[model samples]
Target chain A: MNEGETRKPIIVLVRPQLGENIGKAARAMLNFGLTEMRLVEPRDGWPNPSAGPAASGADIVLNRAQVYASTADAVADCAHVYATTVRKRGVTKPVVTPAEASSEIAAAQGRSAILFGPERSGLETEDVALARAILTVPINPEFGSLNLAQAVILCAYECSKHEGLVQPTQEDLLPPAPQEELDGLIAHLESMLEPKGYFRPEARAEATRRTLRGVLTKPAWNHLEVRTLRGVLSSLQREPRL
Target chain B: MNEGETRKPIIVLVRPQLGENIGKAARAMLNFGLTEMRLVEPRDGWPNPSAGPAASGADIVLNRAQVYASTADAVADCAHVYATTVRKRGVTKPVVTPAEASSEIAAAQGRSAILFGPERSGLETEDVALARAILTVPINPEFGSLNLAQAVILCAYECSKHEGLVQPTQEDLLPPAPQEELDGLIAHLESMLEPKGYFRPEARAEATRRTLRGVLTKPAWNHLEVRTLRGVLSSLQREPRL
Candidate 1:
């Protein structure tokens, strides 16, 4: 198995009824970098046309999905298995949150499988009995309903946090402008305000300048940004050219 | 405002095009215990029929969603407003992840708001200018596409972690039974196992019994649960036929 495959926990769908829901689950998985999908007797069967539209463009998960006849077979090769269910069964087992489970999965050797039950009824007692641990979240008491996609997203998101995923849109921020540049900017603003009588009443001039400095320093302005802002202030002080 | 309304952060949707995405975003918010959704000039108007089915049954969010003519109006009362955007608009501002933003929102005084932009274009530079900070996430560099609902879930999930929402599925774990009751449980189990010659060999018996005590005491079983376990063990020792 490749690094991506080994690192990611297998999302095992046990007796999923709807192809659309499976697709949505796949979409949720891919959003967090989880790609391997295992289907245990999907009601609509694999390669369903309905799943594609719901999956959007997460074709990698769907194309690589493996089908099995039973939940046991799906997770047989895995050393760690976590059954995703809210209710507690008669059997005694360690309970964990998705965050805790993902952390364990990250550290554990061999393969790990996270089992998600059918959409409408969730996991049966028999399905949960096979797992080493039960994974659950604290949800609203009045409305405890969570769709398949939402459930998958919650677990996948926790797993994603531990991985070194790159933040594509994150801005490469420049360091804060030097103290001299900031002082210059503050002095220029004070100079413009002086003539406008904005600092009026000599007694309050010191207090007013302090307040102005506080506001300007709130944002850690980069050197380039400070320069641009100074240019704007200079333009405001001078004559405007068409 | 009620405690619920005041403590929770406001979700502002700026220029949302489709009703389904709005509904989906609302669903994500409610899942994480957030209410109070503010819409800034939703395209195709409010009360769109397409939103209901898509929301899956998060009626409270849809019912109480407030609409504003502009982003300014939506966040007018908010003391801390975070703009959810990824692009660098040549502006200086503090950038924070959803987890960081939610933590700050949780600690902030007065009301706070999280602004999400449109589907195709995301937040405009002018729209982002009004925010106190920029909220963003580390996404896939090659494919940095996040749907409206997905983005909402990312932020909402982080915020929800702070709220003490009831997990209906969570076991009603009573506090560890009082010390007296726990001692009785250990004594009773030891008495029951004594007769069956379960603790064989005098030398190893004490060690084995200690191990048994350790195992029984691990789960912080409540008083009622202890009593139930005692009853189960008693019945197991006494019965042969149904």
Candidate 2:
């Protein structure tokens, strides 16, 4: 684990019944870079074969999991704990959404633990009693059922924001094709359309081409795509080959 | 379908090839109260039995699923069309996250459609060209593999927030326990822990109790949970009982 991983909150599953659910929870945690998993009395025991396939590729979480006899023991050393639940659960602690808790956890000193209850009923009162704060999201009351993995992913996703995890969409991508290439592509399309009557009346040819340009230029096609489209037009011409 | 469901954005799956993926997307949409689904040129044909089990219980989405010959035909009536994709795709349309786009779709004057591409490869240039804007999520650079359901859920969850969908945690919630009950509960635990030397040295006892009170009061437990805990305490004081 890296320094960030060491400082990240540990996920504690209290009496989780299904090995598949545990595996999915593991997958969700690792997706956001949280790998420390503490299992409190997993029903099928540790190293359940059913988990590996379901986890897809989140093996590190399952391998590094520490089993604790109880929820309190699992989070004994953590300075803060957030218990997730669907109901009010009669706990009088501060109610926080996952986003709110994630920010606080990022800024908090020492270790933190987030508790998830079982798949069927969720965290019991005793389990919730151990948390420093209740982390419950506003969800459909009639169908307040968020599968274990969904809940974990939501929390992990929020937590990931503060970790500065890499974002593909945020990268300095290759810029749109050079102006000349775009212009060439437009000219090529116009030439092809001119004989096909796509431009229609000679009086409206300019305006029609402008609208077509607006449609074609809207997509920030890269150089390669422009080349590919030019190639496609060439193939459609007389005897041209790919 | 509910009244608000009529105004909800239509989900358009363009050139989707897999049945299971379509099913899962349907499930995600329904989870967030979205049911309208339009498929453009599904390779496996419509009404694939394979979709039923994977959809879990989102039959309404399946039942109402519409098939279209092209993306344009699918979204022809939509005033706003947001296409989801990771790459820039040479599309110069304005980009927005699911949350930002959901808000706009909610307030827009006419019908809105959010298009998702296939599982193997996202929308083609022609497919994306039909959109008025782009809707994509910020994801990991190295592994931008978000399955169909996960992507659908992110956008649907955001839209649900704007739809004012019923929230279990927000409604019919029992009021927080009265201050007197909270105090009594604190005292009850203190009384129980006192003789066992739970507070430890007299010098730190006050601080310990203060911390305990903080933990107990943070959950915002309702009267029901307070009573249950008090019953638990009463039971602990006597013989063991269920």
In model 1, residue pairs whose N, Cα or C atoms come closer than 3 Å (at least 3 residues apart or on different chains), thus clashing, are: A167-B138
Looking at every candidate separately, what fraction of the true A–B Cα contacts under 8 Å does it contain? Answer: 0.13, 0.06
List each candidate's DockQ score.
Answer: 0.06, 0.03
Question: How well is each residue in A47-96 modelled by candidate 2, as lDDT tens digits?
Answer: 78888877878887899999999886787666567899876754446678
The top-ranked prediction according to TM-score is 1
Candidate 1's displacement at residue B148, Å, is 1.9
Prediction 2 global C-alpha lDDT: 0.74
- In order, the Cα lDDT scores of the candidates are 0.76, 0.74
Please, what are the lDDT tens digits per residue for candidate 1 over residues B55-76?
Answer: 7788888988988898867876
Best by lDDT: 1
> How does chain B score by TM in each prediction?
0.66, 0.75
